[model samples]
Target: MPNPAPVPDHVPPDLVRDFSYFTGPGMCPMRGGDPQGALADLHDGPPVFYAPNNTYDGYGTWVFVRAEDQRRVLQDAETFSSHRRIFEKALGYDLPTIPLEIDPPEHGAYRSLLNPLLSPKRVMAMEAANRARAAELIDGLAAKGHCEVMTDFAFPFAVGVFLEFLGLPQSRREEFLGWADKQFHGTPEERGEAIRTVIAFMEELVALRRREPAEDFMTFVVEARVGGRAMTDKEAVGMGALLFVAGLDTVAAAIGFDFRYLAENADAQDRLRADPGGIVLAVEELLRMFPTVLMTRIAACDTEFDGIAIKAGDRISCPSMVANRDPAEFPDPNRIDLARENNRHVAFAYGPHRCLGSHLARRELVIAMEEWLKRIPAFRITPGTAPLTYGGHVFGIEDLRLDWEVG
Candidate 1:
């Protein structure tokens, strides 16, 4: 583990806490771990605390534990810049993850250019393909009556749909998955290598699309104009790289968490199975209960928020799991209510920097759950075997061996 950075002089010692997404309680790898739920205790302390060594690169950050406070911090992008340069260390220079890392006004153009591609209507048009992919994977696993949900269905289903949207051939699924695994879950050196590998792939893709334009996403990007000019190589590569990284892991982790919940809570599974219409609402509830992404921001300049001192260049972490469980935000924050109503959870972060692929991700989760419940009967964690989960920049599940009677 990287050494935690020294706390800044401006931060109050009373407000500093020893917590991090990498090694905090319930954050470490464990069987049947509740990485999200474990942080609910934060609400009992200060709503905002300084956590030294909070990031993958071992930097201190002000941890915001309340939903409303997080909303203010995230929405006020001017004060809390989103230009985190998340891939800087790995790539050996600054390469903002476009739209995601770009702050407002300047961020608007890129967002507008890409929003239509993933709007609700566009996602609806892709529903058949998404559902088909989910069904295909589930059907293949249904007969076995037991399988590792993450590898057998979740990763393939989510990554395949994303690949299709990106206009990449399915033949490259394993290769992309390998890179995603190393990129998101590997050692620092491995992560840097994976980051370089993905950028190289995207660079090649941009070059290919420029030479041989096709009816695919990269083609459209290469041809499309932003600010009345075609996108530059770096811009194009950033767009593709962001999509590649964002699209691969998050939805799959969600599917794993959702299935794990259903497997453990048979009543909830049976309820959703009996009333398939409820799956949409149930998915929202599940997303609220088990979000995997952590939103981080850099203090654009020295600013005071909620009476806490923040310094320029300081990292700020707004964990979705922590905010979703804030008592002030949800009525019964801990309960898993499948039919939750008026749920405005920030499973996807708020403000202009909200996840661009959220529409497709939502439909994908609903379809995965709907198809799985419809095709497979009651299932549970395979006896004596545990699904190992861990917390980090992104939380994930592994060895999720679910089983059911083969009929």
Candidate 2:
């Protein structure tokens, strides 16, 4: 990036002591993943500085983004690996998550197994039922004066849809819900505890699937002797855990944000209330605009971008929240115009490593928006409550509190 207009070099005196320990290594959130602070740092300069592990994000600041450089950075994925070192170190296992951490020719093998499972046709088969389920979920909460969207609605909505797709039994609902909340969105200490709990449950679940071999994704994985030998017990457990960890929180955040958006924007809410038909595209645009989950990829080989050099093995993150809001691509980027042109956002990511569950996620969002809009025709945000924004870059939420009059 070319040099920018110079601003006065003034660091607050109190910030002086704070800066002493501030990695000065740029904006790694792991060192302390504060969205407001990170965005502040981003605005301060370009070619962002970073360390493998910063406080905001565990391996915080290394994942950096310059929206203008998105296309080229993703195109050369050979060197930008998704197999995060920090993540592997934390998990203590080199477990397979397939196309997620693999590169090129070898990656295609895993996709072969996953593609059929996540295909549009396969996903479409489940949509009608999920929509009904979503509608039912909203029906339970629509007229209430106040309700917590995440716990009462969004969390269960996404998890239930995923469980249905995997053919997992419904009895494990509370177990999965508690564990998922702690694992990703929980505090650092809580995250560690959540990981251990999830492993135990997944282990038992995988073992059961191996023995009976139901016609679910786990069964397909357990019995498929092709590509990779019938997946080991641990691998099956890990795969289930991976999907649970990745899918549930993301969908919840998206749904939660959709509600928050509508609660605040009467015009937008009115449009959808009169006709839920607008939900399909509106949800897509919302997903594009508010990326609740951040994307991470590690640089495998030394690379250069827009003249700045990225060393091999350097961890980097591209928060879709930033890319999706890019001014260059979306005119009046902040406005929630459902008709925005050239609307592809990296919210689901770019390149071949895009979300395998996109079909399911898209349908879920559509169903979620449609069902909620109809039930919640005229609702307002609770007065004296904080605004809703996805909380953190890694795992965020819409946290909207809405009330509507009955009769």
Candidate 3:
């Protein structure tokens, strides 16, 4: 039973051609080394719209700019829709994930399904608990003085927070963790195995919630309503999968990438350690540089601007990673300056679909950085290590190889 008022059906060719960012060959085509370079690319070009690569069809993007020319693009909900079917089509799932890919007024209702628990007050309540959890993990391994930051710290930290929030028991936490890790990982074959295991577990949990109705996020979600009608089981499951990825791995990537960048730049780490207050601005800068998720969205109707053509039904991707470094917005964008005030970098994106979990993510990051810097501020990256890089749909380091000391 498809919802009434089907997704808009008239994407224009002119609009598609001018909106190109993620359709081409590179990951972050602009921001890393020089902010000026980023601005030039966004400005000097013919309005930075999507252009077709020779190899692909119906794929293009216009990475939006933060400059005066396009400031309203992020806030203009009417023109830029967030209905996210691109992933479903790519992954071959007829059913879509909740909220992340959907647009208003449906997107608005779906988000209400989980927004209460993610509110700032709730996040503050979780912060102390998160700090304790971070301390426990760090204390357990502080003596070792060296570990695989990704697997040892970030992975467990992400899963533990999510599991606790969902109120999963100790016995079943690993089942959820392992399955969720692979749920967004590997080939379709690998993905199928992960999806089945995790969904089965979620179904069982849903049943348990039905019977017992424990006090947790699981119960909250199970009992969520829109216009007074309760969410269905499938809706619950779709949202389960959504939250699993949304709450867990993206946090993992954000933390892991931050560590990798800090490990490589001891000078910046020293500065951060000296001030500590730098943590907040440093957090903003890091987000500017290392937004983990890439572009999304397929246009709903024909649109045109800047002499490019975007046609209806064309697959378009909006590249956030590329946009944040856009030189027109952030001068010297590659360099991280803690004092970069008025820095309106759109790392979490803009508009109605701007990352709902931004608040929670920022809190976790601030805590994680505080704990790490307090204990291991002057650490050096392990000698003889050429840091390995991994990129797929997302970008992060495989292992942040570092050997730190505390005297």
Candidate 4:
């Protein structure tokens, strides 16, 4: 095991916990592991504690386990800044991931510019295409009897929709998927290379859109104005890079986890298959139970939070999985209630930086489930195989071999 970062003197010794997203119990890669469920145990610990070596880069972070505290910390952006320059280490320079890293007043303008493009109405309009894409992928897989979820349907379907939105050619689908895999799951050196590769692609895309404007997201960004001025090259590249990274990974991972859940729970699968209308609500419940992202913030200045001393630059981690499982937030938090009401779960996060693509993501998930159940019959994890799950910057499942009786 690598050496853990030293705990800051200001952090009370009693508050420090030997926890890490990369190395925590059930967090590491394991077959049939429940990374998110493993984190639910955090509720039994202190509401807030310092976790040494929690981040991908080996920095200590203050972990908030309760939904209420996470909401407060996430909602109060000024105190806990979101501008962590997350891609700086990989890119070797500071490149804020657009509106995600921008705070409040400045964040508002960028969000306003992009929100309408992905609003509920817009997502509804895109549903037909999304549905068609999901159906096309599922149709191709139905005859196979058994297939790996990620490569067979999840990544292709999710990334296809993302590529369509970005106006990229589907011919490069495999190439783009390769970059995404490397960036998210590859070794450190490979991840850096993938990051650089994606950035280069985005830069080229920005230039292409500027010179030969098209009716696509990149083109819109190239010509769009933010803060009463045209977006700079860096800003355009940042936006595209953020979209490429964000759009490709999380939704696909979500689809993987969602299918894994259905594969294990035949009753849930049968219910959703019998009552397709319930899928919309079921998707929300599934999201609550298996969220994959961890929101991290850097302290803007030293301040006391709930009697805890937080110094400037301290990392605050608000794990959506842990928060979603907070008993105070959701009664019987571990129960998989398909008809869960008033969920208000933070799968997309809370406050100003809530995921901009949440609407699109929700639509994609709902459509995926609807199409799968409509086309494929009851299925389960293929016998003699297991889905490998891991926790890190993001939680993901792989080798999700699912099987069903063939005609």
The C-alpha RMSD in Å for every predicted model, in order, reads: 0.8, 6.4, 5.7, 1.0
Ranking of all predicted structures according to lDDT, beginning with the best and ending with the worst: 4, 1, 2, 3
Q: Per-residue alpha-carbon lDDT of model 4 for 114-233, expressed as tens digits?
A: 999999999999999989999999999899888999999999999999999999998999999999899887887788899999999999999999899999999999999998898999
lDDT of 4: 0.92
At residue 195, candidate 3 shows an lDDT of 63
Q: Which is better, 1 or 3, measured by lDDT?
A: 1
**What lDDT would each prediction earn against the true structure?**
0.91, 0.66, 0.63, 0.92
How close to the true structure is residue 306 of candidate 1, measured as C-alpha lDDT?
69
Could you tell which candidate, 1 or 2, scores higher by lDDT?
1
The local lDDT score (0 to 100) that residue 239 gets in candidate 2 is 68
Query: How many clashing residue pairs, candidate 3?
Result: 35
- Return whichever of 1 and 4 wins on lDDT: 4
Model 2: residues with Cα > 4 Å off, grouped in runs: 1-64, 85-87, 387-393
Q: What tens digits encode model 2's per-residue C-alpha lDDT throughout 185-247?
A: 566667767776777777777778777877788788777654646667765766676687678
lDDT of 3 by residue, 118-143 (tens): 88887998888898888778777666
CA deviation > 4 Å runs, candidate 4: none
Q: Kindly indicate the candidate among 2 and 4 with the higher lDDT.
A: 4
